[model samples]
Target: MGRLLSKEDVLAYAIASTALSTGGGGVGPSLESVAKMYDDAIAKGARPELIELSEVPDDAIVTSVVATGGGVSPEMMMRWGGRGGRLRRDLPFGRFDPEYIRDKILENDATWCPLNSWSKIPGPDFRRKAWERLKELIGGKEIFSRLFFEISPFVTRDLCYMSLEGMKAIDATCAGYRAAPEISQSGLNLADVKCTPAVITTVWGDLLILEEVLCFQRAEEIVEGIATYSGGVAGGPFALTGKEAKKGMIPGCISFTIDIGKAILKARESGDDIAEAIVDASKGRAFKLFEGKIAEYWQEPKYSFIWGMVKIKGTGKYAGHRFKAWYKNEFHISWLDDKPYVTSPDGINVIDPKTGWGLANFWPAEWEPGREVVVIGVKNDERWETPRGLKLFGPQHFFFDIEHVPIDKIYKNFE
Candidate 1:
């Protein structure tokens, strides 16, 4: 007979698989990123440890981590599988430059879990929907005693939901929530996988459903469905655990393909392979569903030596790539772009406060990382960069530094 498979075994296998691909870089003793996540989990008071997969009970609750397109996604990324072209209508690829392109590439391949695999997904909600439909085949009252649950690691980033009180609740519900899955995502390095018990409710289900529905190809449909029900935000849905609206995780029943597996019972005349069905149900369906969405905005990443970087935005140390937008702040000064505004050792200078034009051969943000006095803004020639706006000797006299100027001060002119 084949060995009995447990939820813990599946999780362990995934970690092992990723490690093989990373060539021993994941969850290793020296991996700081992985370690930090563990430490953070412990500090939060959840006993997250790593251990052999064999330790998990057959009935213990397990949550799967789904990750995909690690960061912001371009229009093309949304259209996966054979249907990509048909669905490709107008995908948004925001402002592009050297830095922007590099960010997009890294975002796609960054070490992730749950949704993204070493290469591909389960085929367009393929894994999830398949499981839900499978239920039709195996109706109630006959087999398994518990419910199947799944989740994505990315949603854990919701600071509001992952509160101290929240973890305690989760820990209390489940005998023990495993801590080794995304050890890198945690602050602890030493992982001693632990498992006890876990429980979930529709409250959890509602949250997962909303998050994914919005990110799916049929977002509009999901939103409409959510509108029919209560406990939603003005424009989005949230975890249903009596929390505020969070359109992060959407949960629901997905359809499955029947032909993939034989009857639930292959032994008895009036029965099927009840044992196999129990095992299969305990795990997920041949197919799985993933309901998630990418955010509309991402933060503009600042790079420096301390960040272990150089030559970015087509200049600096790592040049050649065009500077582009990975995530644009609601507002940013296009004048400076990705280039650092450096300053010299000399004291600050200013043109006219009313005229916001001044220039310095150097900017402060460009200097090496160290405690150094930085002159705010300085001016030299007719064309200079100044925090007090700029004064151009030329006729056009362009001024775009409105950002630095105070709202009230803008109407007044200073000598």
Candidate 2:
């Protein structure tokens, strides 16, 4: 039977999903706003629901919804390479192309540009227009379920928003626990499920539909390029059948995110360790990676991605040691005392020690120096352990030469 979620459930999911989002998934003040939207939405009669993949009929249609463009705020980007702080001009994804950025987005009278900080970013209702456009294309086909493109507060909010339109949330995601930098990182690619007939929409009212894609790689380039120029977007591909959803999604993640949130809330109420609560919620699949104070942080916007790194000075048992992590919207690589540690497809979360909130990399202020944090490693979905999955998500895929190591094995080795 499908389960109907209460307002509290979604509130919890919003908070907990941030921790699971690695370093991305719309954390910080944005997450606070998402939580409020949930309460407000539910108060106005929205009843979000979740169902297992098995509950969907073979003919049931599943629609994927997502927003692109997660780079640091224009305010932060404006501060780059100024005064004492410095940021890398590029990484293996390729060098930052200023001329290309200028020609594509700035010259088009974009609200936010290198010279101006007035960001015309997407709003909470960003998807409404896109959804309407998609509805027009799909005709009268009732959407059986809404699939999460990734884990984040936005995902839960999208769930509630769709429920208001009568679509249930699928207890699954295209990516695993953490967010990915590319659309091609989705399990849909691994399962050979196509995501064409995709709809890409921007806040400025521009809409484009992809009747077909040559491959996942081409789709990523096309969608990301458009999003890059449009200053972020909403809308995604649809036409996933129940059988295809079962094959292309990582299931049970919604409940798992809620469980983690519930654990944290219970711990806070009982005056227990929030970090320990997270570990317990994962049923031992998560482990405390470090307890530390932010020692240094650096970030810059590149190609609609917030690429950055953070250094943490250890405390307590980890005293005298240091840890560092690198991210492209989400943390993808880490090192303990400068030795290679956990990498992508696994999670590396920097969380508030007391509140258990994820300190998002997308928002640079969250990682300011002196903030105390607890870093944790949660296991990725089992599907990511395969060769194809590794090829798509591992450290090497991000141009890092390090091998992908499972969280448990990394912890065991550290011990």
Candidate 3:
């Protein structure tokens, strides 16, 4: 049986998903939009629900729904001052009222929810076109649900918006617990699931259906091209059936994110240490890597991805050590005191000790010099340790010469 999600679950999932994003995906400002989405759903009397993968009928049609685009930091828009694009330069991403987000951002008239397309919000038009195209391609089979492509605040927000439209949320994710830079990095791809027969859509109402793709790499390039040209896009390849989803997707990840979120919220209310609470919430899969202050940070938007590095000077017990991490939207590599420490296929979560929110690489200004942060390394799903998984997500894929090491082996409960 499936369970209905309470309004609080949506809010909790937002905070938890951001904290687990490993410093990529959407950032903090987007949470305000999520809050409004749930409120709107309640006003409409829609109940968002989640069901286990086993509960889905074997023949049910599904597709991974995701937004594609380079995210612009809200702080960047304030600097550009409406000169770069159609978005209002006056307010940051979260600064807009719900009406403004609903009227402007959600309507695709302007940009918010991190990209110019506003596909992350899955507004009415984007939703309609995507479903129409997907249903058409699938020969009018009822698309039972929209599968979450990644674990991030944007997807969590979209889940609420989608639930209101009658799509049951599956408590699973194709991209595992943390965000990855490429679609091919997903557990689905590693499990040899096909990504073709895909649908791609732009906010301008344009649609492109890739009847077939030679490989996931080609599919990724094509999607990247569309996003690069249109500033952003939304839509995904048909996931076909529940059997395929169960085989490829990481199950229970949404529930896991919510549990972590609830833990953080509860700890905050009880005045408990947020960092410790997060580790406890992760249930031994996560451990403290470094506690420090941001010393230097540099990031640039390149090829529709946030690319950068951060240097942290340790404090407290970690004093005298230094930490460095590099990212292409998501952190892929890190070094502690000049020695390779943790790498992708493992999660490196940078959290603000003050608020327990994951500090995003794009929002450097918010986590600028002197901000205290707790870096947590989370063990990736055991499935990610397979040879095929490592080939796709390991350090080699990121141009690093080091061998892939599990987070547990590298940190081993560094308290």
Clashes of each: 94, 0, 0
Regions more than 4 Å wrong, model 2? 28-39, 65-67, 72-129, 136-139, 412-415
Per lDDT, the best of the predicted structures is 2
Q: State in Å the error of residue 82, model 1.
A: 38
> Of the candidates shown, which would achieve the greatest TM-score relative to the real structure?
3
C-alpha displacement of 152 in model 1, angstroms? 9.5
Which candidate would rank higher by lDDT, 1 or 3? 3
Instruction: Report, for every candidate in turn, its global Cα lDDT versus the true structure.
Output: 0.21, 0.75, 0.74
TM-score of each: 0.19, 0.84, 0.85
| Candidate 3 lDDT by residue in tens digits, 283-352 | 8877889999999888776445677889999898888899999888889899989999899889888998
lDDT of 2 by residue, 1-415 (tens): 6798876677678778878888887643344565677777788778778888678898888776434565534543342211122232112221123333434445445444344365553444554666666777778677776778777866766666767777778888788777777887888889999777778775444567888778776887777666665554334656678888888888888888989988988887899999989998898779899989999999877566778899999988888999999998889999999999888888899999898888877567567799999999988888898999998898878899898888888873234
lDDT (Cα, 0-100) at 392 in candidate 2: 86
Query: How does candidate 3 fare on TM-score?
Result: 0.85
Q: Would you give me the overall lDDT of model 3?
A: 0.74
User: Candidate 1: where are CA atoms >4 Å away?
Assistant: 1-46, 51-58, 63-312, 325-415
